[model samples]
Target chain A: MTTVFKKTPVLTDTVMHYCPGCGHGIVHRLVAEVIEELGIQDRTIGFVPVGCAVFGYKYFAVDCVEAAHGRAPAAATGCKRVNPNNVVFTYQGDGDLASIGAAEIVHAAHRGEKITTIFINNAIYGMTGGQMAPTTLVGQKTTTSPYGRDPEHCGKPLRVAEMIATIEGAAYVERVSVDSVPNIIKAKAAIKKAFQCQLDGKGFALVEVLSSCPTNWGKSPAEAMDWIKSDMIPYYPLGVKKDRTNE
Target chain B: MVSKVTIDENRCKGCGLCVRACPKKIMQLSKTKLNEKGYHPAEVIDQGACIACASCARTCPDAVITVEKE
Candidate 1:
């Protein structure tokens, strides 16, 4: 039998540093696979932030950069501006993207930077020991919001994909998840399209993936996947939030 | 028909997410085996009955399993 499928060559031999049930690994593989399929490994540059995936540069065989906290988008902007032909993207978590680096991403998308971004929205912050992030759902209990995120005190969970879709410079914006096999396929397709938007010189593209944080969510790996279906999907929804490429 | 699922013992993190994802219910964690990472790697129980559905491989967070069909 032929080798129908296996780990993409884009990933290195180093085992990921993510938690046991974390979705980062799955998403990473998808991104690497997409790069491999597109034959852009040599030209791709991934930027990671100062979170659990800070060492993401080591995981992928592509040339990757470890940017400061919440600065991945800004860093990608610089790289794309200098090397317009390079395929640049950022792998950012909710806390890093929706919180600290909000302005960076906003301006980057607003300027229609020709780059792709993979946004992992697992609600709670994973790298910092489960703190309440900007994407944390209301009533979600994080380390920072021990009693449960109180909407009365803090605002509701940010709908990042929707918010970014409103910006004119963003050519493609889609929200997908890895909660199941079918969803996983859809997530990959969305990610591929996001990258294609940039490759075609359309504009900014971002695929917001609703991922799992099992360890931080105080749930089993299986339960975390289920949680994405029950809680996360309802809030984030699933589909193309924006597609300016065809227009 | 012959098919089996091969898992990279060392790369497996024993998360059991694939165990739940497998529709055939053929995957199990090795209680007697531990990888270099100190986690029990996943194992196949009924390799002969494997259909190479790849659900296990798809659900694996680590990309640790490879399903072969013949």
Candidate 2:
């Protein structure tokens, strides 16, 4: 039989552990495809966090290490330092990266660590039963913020990409989403470039993926996609934050 | 045309919407089982009857479904 689409080599044969309509599977596939295309699967070392994407290590076909909540960046830093010849990347969620690990991520970028960081911001905490995260939108209703996120009491969402772009140590930063085919393509390109930045010996590189949590948002898969386009995109605009070599 | 339905067990909030969305009467919620993320997911029965319409997957809020043809 002719094959229209087959599983990518970088993905494991085991079934995925993501939720239905969760964007982690799509993002994981994109990253895997890029790793295969770049032929860096064998040399890539991945650090996974403790949020919804904690099982990322099991999905990818590269060497992976699991870190404590919001500690992937620190772990990736140590990994890169020890294995200078290999490529290192960290796959983190908003709750893990933007909240608990915010300090670690900021320092990693401030120091210009030669590594790639994939930040998946779905607006809420998924693994911990849909709590309000640092990236949750204003007026967004989460389990912790049942009355909607009040800016006065809860503060505002952290725009990590824009903030990191201002740091001279960071050579590349971008925020993209997979709400549509076009957006998914753009996200893949940004992710590939983030890795390429590391390969080129550039400074800190990060890709913030504006993803969806349909279950938490109480919207269907299609509606969640629409929300990312209509609501999330405006708050986290899709584009490259910075590029040192203009590549 | 065969329809596809996938379940992301970990991401499932145990909402049972997939069971309600399946019009072909081929899905059900798991009660005796729980995934790594601590949620019971709807399982597919009689996979051969799927119409590839993706209704269950589309209606899912968690994006847990991955439907494909046989």
Candidate 3:
């Protein structure tokens, strides 16, 4: 029998610590698959952020570095600069990327660091007991925003993909989700492209994945997927926000 | 052509994504059995009905499903 689907070897045998149905597991698999398919596992380096995926290094078989909160991009930049021949990427969540690491990510992209970033924007902070993150939707209730996020007080959700796309050094930027089968395929393709951008010596590349935090959202895993389609998509439209590889 | 679906019971976290992704509705979580993790692992209700589209394997967050076709 021909195998239609199998787990990628780039992922270690370690069972992920992510919650059941958490988007982090799906994204983690896609990143591992990409690395395996590209045959870059031997020379790939991943920078894991301080969030729910803090144990990312344990899951991915490639060399990894744990960065300070919201400092994945900065650490990734240094890694890429030091090991110009190796593939470098960062796995970060909204709390780490859009909030604490905002300046770090922006500056990394602005400088056109040769690295890829897999940004998981689940709209709320998952690791910290579902606190409101910078990307939290207005009127969305979280532990910190009990009555729903108030735009007057929180301003609004930060569109990291669009914000990073505007920077000159960002060579490729796309926003995708894992709420459905087709979207999952597209998300994987976008992730591959982002990694490819870095492999080609192109500047910074980031793929913002609109993930789900079922535990924090206080919804069933299925309901969380629907919420991503019904609510999150409206605010953070999916598409390629920027691409300079063709230029 | 016949298709085969395998689920690593212990690895499954009972997310039910495969149950939802299966176009044939053959995938279902075991109601009477729980894995070592205490989660009801997913299983195929009717192996003959599986089309081997790998949709279940694709959507599985835990990567517990493996699809093969002959």
Candidate 4:
């Protein structure tokens, strides 16, 4: 058979530990393809956060550094500064980014750190057994919120992309999903642009991907993807939120 | 017109995302067979109708699906 779609070399042959249907695998491939397409694999430095993707170092065939929960931005900033020629990026989950690492990511963007951040927002925290994350939707029941997420008690879900776009140092911010082929294609383009923005030294670029958590959300892989389409997109909304690179 | 879709059984996690992704609703998970991964991988039920849309390959998290258009 004639070859059409094959795995990218940037991804290691190691089998991924991600739960089947989780969005991490798709996002990882997109990031790997972006790096190889840009020819920066030789000098790319990845910072994997403490989440389901904590072991991301083993999956990507590139230099990787493990960072504490919510500390990837800090590590990525230092990496980019010390090795200015190298491309530095971070892979973080909603719990790791919007909650614990919120301060670090905000400061990194504030400082105009020349690095890219691949933020995966599945709403509920994974790996830690489906705890409610900062991005969890209202009334969405999680392990931590058995009765559903109450807005009066928990306040509203944080819109990280919209909030980050206001920061003066942010170069690019876009939210995409992987529920369908068209959306997945858009996600690849957004991811590529985020990396390019960093390569061009624009500033701190972030691609907030609204991902699916089938195992955690107590839904089939297909239902989880549908959840993203019906619920997540309404609140998160897709497309670029900011682009200071044009300036 | 001939087209084909193949799955790398070892890498397949039996996620079933590809089954939902198929526009023609032709993909299904094996009920009686398991791959080396201990999971039943997806297979095409109506190979002749496959348009080589590659939607299954794109939605597959493991990148195990390969599509060829002829």
CA-lDDT, candidates in order: 0.91, 0.83, 0.94, 0.93
RMSD to the hidden true structure, all candidates: 1.0, 5.7, 0.6, 1.2
In lDDT terms, which candidate is top?
3
Give the Cα-based TM-score of candidate 4 against the true structure: 0.97
Candidate 3 vs 4: which has more lDDT = 3
TM-score of chain B of each: 0.94, 0.81, 0.97, 0.95
Instruction: Give the poorly placed runs of model 4, Cα more than 4 Å off.
Output: none
What is candidate 3's lDDT per residue for A164-236, written digit by digit as tens?
A: 9999999999999999999999999999999999999989999999999999999988889999999999999
Give the DockQ (2 decimals) of all models.
0.72, 0.10, 0.88, 0.74
lDDT of 2 by residue, A1-247 (tens): 2222334688786566676667887788878878988889999999999988888878889999999998888989998998888999999999999999999999999999999999999999998899999999999999999999999998999899999999888999999997865677788899999998899998799999988887789997657878998999999998989989464
Worst 10 residues of 2 chain A by lDDT: A1-10
Q: Please state the interface RMSD for every predicted structure, separated by commas.
A: 1.1, 6.5, 0.6, 1.2
| Candidate 3 chain A: 10-residue stretch with minimal lDDT | A74-83
- Candidate 4, which CAPRI tier? medium
Superior candidate under TM-score, 3 versus 4: 3
For model 2, the superposed segments whose C-alpha errors exceed 4 Å read A1-4, B1-70
TM-score of 1: 0.98
Choose the strongest candidate by DockQ. 3
Return the TM-scores of chain A for each candidate in numbered order. 0.99, 0.97, 0.99, 0.98
* Candidate 4 residue pairs in clash (backbone atoms < 3 Å): none
Q: Write the per-residue lDDT of candidate 4 for residues A91-157, one digit (tens) a residue.
A: 9999999999999999999999999999999999999999999999999999999999999999999
